[model samples]
Target: MAETVFARTPRLVWRAGTPDDVEALYAIVSDFDVVRQTETWPWPADLSFTRSRCIVTASDQGASGVVCQGDEVVGYLGLSPEGKIGYMFGKFYWGRGLATEIGAAAVAYAFDRFDWQCLEACVFADNPASGRVLEKLGFEEGNACQGPCRARGGVYPIRTFRRPRA
Candidate 1:
């Protein structure tokens, strides 16, 4: 299947992922450091688990795409049907400001493509860097909650952030 281009930044291209791209993505996501910051991606993630994410259908309710620099998959971005957005980048990409750049693009794309009252994101309380990114994109801190982390293998405190329609 042809990968659909979702959005692009000066340094990144946001596009639909394919099964062919799974191995590279898996390498990034399976890293303990990377997955620990995410609420959904499993630690020790297998190829099958990664493949399941790459296999997107047109009927899929929300955006699930790879963040690329030229041909390299640097990260993954997901915006669920429930309006929760999340992202994770490979270790090499950390501290690069790519997350905030891609995030701003994702926020614009979400509000433009869908009629949502706001876009929300869940940041693990420990991951203040992600919380900062959400804030950079105009999300304000909301209520706290707890959720299971597939990587952490337990529930973790979460800080919710939301960017309401202007």
Candidate 2:
């Protein structure tokens, strides 16, 4: 594996995923709304389907993190080999600037540890909070695509954003 990006924000520590983390990871990722927001898949219970997804996730992605605020795992973030980073927070932990703060650390860590020149994120148009966080973190909005972006259950505009090289 390549070097993992460990992000340290004021409120959270973002670290890579492990086999041991499946349970907690499952809890966060399986949240109905959160899953729907980030994925193009159906709502899944903790059965073989979800387990396989987790196993393959461990195999394919080099960096996965158990997001921790001290002793509690608040959320998770991932950096793909292609330089795309996906993130989500626990529903209870939202609206506290935690996402942007974690995003800042993740972005910085990606730039520093991976020598990445840029990073990209995809957000459903309905989610303004995500867009604002990306913009506040200096991600420039890109073109939008009309999509049935799996989660929304209908065709809608999908906006892309990117953080350019400094």
Candidate 3:
């Protein structure tokens, strides 16, 4: 049997997402409330397992981990293909500091494993909670701009943040 290694926090575990995690991942991300602050996810997210599989399998470019509390997948955090930092947790897990913990771990992993000098993040102007997460993780706010938020089906103002590897 293969052993499963996990990145951990006081109350959560983080591990590389695999194809086996697709269902659990979909369950978390498919919740409209869970992704309402996101820029890319469609409101009625394409509930395709294949799409989820692609996300899990593409973690080779950067770090990607499923945030868990015991066996339940509560969220995910990772660097995107474009090298930006991103994360999302189940609505139930919000306000518990899980995103901040996961963000810290992912940032450390990215700096250790990749040659990138810095990582960037963008949060919708309306979602200050996410902006706070980035701030807590040492990401400094940068210029604001307008971006298409597929979930909202319109262009919305967004604020960008960046964290340089120390």
Candidate 4:
């Protein structure tokens, strides 16, 4: 199958992820700051795992979109079949409004493509920035719970958020 373009923002292109993105993605997830805010990306980045995740099997089509600025991979945005959305960006790209931009696109695409009534997302409680991104996308704060963080090798406090189809 051919790669599909999923979304576009002022500075990013969200497109189907491929194995070729492994290296760039690994670079982003390798940073402790980046992975600590995430749920499952392990610390000490492993190329093998990145490779496995980047593979665009028929099952993953439209699920994992590589966020790029021009030709460089800058981030990842994915929505699971169950309607859980997750995203991450390179450290170099931090302190910008990219997350909020792509988030709006993700919400639009997921709601339209999956026709789900709601989309779910969560952020480590310490990551107020990510929570703000969700809020900017109109996600409502929901629950507070403990969640496993593979990168941190332990559980962390998390805040859940949900966005209803609009």
Candidate 5:
């Protein structure tokens, strides 16, 4: 809930996520392709409104925002409670530069609105696209490690990245 109007890209608007957005949010994150590389999304995707509500509520407390394309919620860009930055978009929006737009908006918000000196992100080793999004936002590559990917149902290689406040 830092600021409702987080940022604006050419085709997308970044705004804070709200409880009412659960349905639209669910549509994006529930897609197997979207959550496959993530750490928290459940595998086989529960596809339940209850789960999406919980996620929206939790994200609402931090710098979480919905990525909108002309009045439609297309994705999410947010900072976790632990200060890590993450995003998810509907598969239809992929490869169209939406992630980069949202990522840059989230990075600016973190540095300008919060006291944290640095922000971190972790991308699955197999997900080079996500890694590129972080890199475009100025996140420097760091150590690589193994982490539990809930959707994958096993440990997966992860690449860590960090960006310090300017």
Candidate 6:
């Protein structure tokens, strides 16, 4: 296994998450707008639940990551064993290259650590910024579909994107 590099991006550190990240993970999970557009995860997220997410992210094949700098967790990302790698940046941390930075690292991890065949993303149709992020990482867009997102407040369409493992 590649000794985790304390992987550096322009601003964030992509490292394996620990139990200590529960609180930081909760901040983003509690943000309906953040988790909703991303996954429709049941909302008004409680700290306990978010804590579990942090621990589980490391174990889940997809939809898991730790976005940190030094020691502060700024954002979180994940790549499911099933080919879904999702990401969410805190509202306070948006607009920086952090998303792309950690995202590329996560993709590298998937390829290097798991011998993953391919990874994919499902973006709510309205969220072009996310699609752009995936594009920057070399993901290609594919079939689109209407989808429901209870956490996002209602149903909406989502587009799918794919990145082949290198």
**What lDDT, from 0 to 1, does candidate 5 have?**
0.79
Candidate 4 lDDT by residue in tens digits, 1-166: 6778888888888887787788898898889899888888888888887777776432432477689999999998888878899999998998799999988988888876776889999999999989999999999999799999998899989999999988
Report the error of model 5 at residue 109, Å: 0.7
TM-scores vs. true structure, each candidate: 0.95, 0.81, 0.87, 0.93, 0.86, 0.85
Off by over 4 Å in 1: 57-60
Cα lDDT tens digits, model 1, 72-157, are 99999988998888899999999999999999898888888888899889988999999999999999999999988998899999
Winner of 4 and 6 under lDDT: 4
Model 3 pairs in collision: none
Local distance difference test scores for all models: 0.87, 0.72, 0.77, 0.86, 0.79, 0.76
* lDDT per residue (tens digit) for residues 1-166 in model 2: 5523376777788775546556766787677777666744446635454344433332243365667798677877777887887777879888989989988887877776676678888887887888998998999999997655454456777789999878
Q: In candidate 4, list every pair of residues with a backbone clash.
A: none
Query: In candidate 2, where is summed lDDT lowest over 10 consecutive residues?
Result: 53-62
Best by lDDT: 1
Q: Quick one: best TM-score, which candidate?
A: 1
At residue 130, give the lDDT of candidate 6. 90
lDDT of 5 by residue, 1-166 (tens): 4546777878888786666677787777778788887888785666564245334523333566688999898987778767799888889998999999878877887777777889999999999999998888899999999999887789999999999889
> For model 4, what is the error of residue 102's alpha carbon versus the real structure, in angstroms, after optimal superposition?
0.9
- CA shift of 104, model 5, Å: 0.9
Comparison by lDDT, 1 against 6, better one: 1
Q: Regarding TM-score, does 5 or 6 come out ahead?
A: 5
Pairwise lDDT winner, candidates 5 and 6: 5
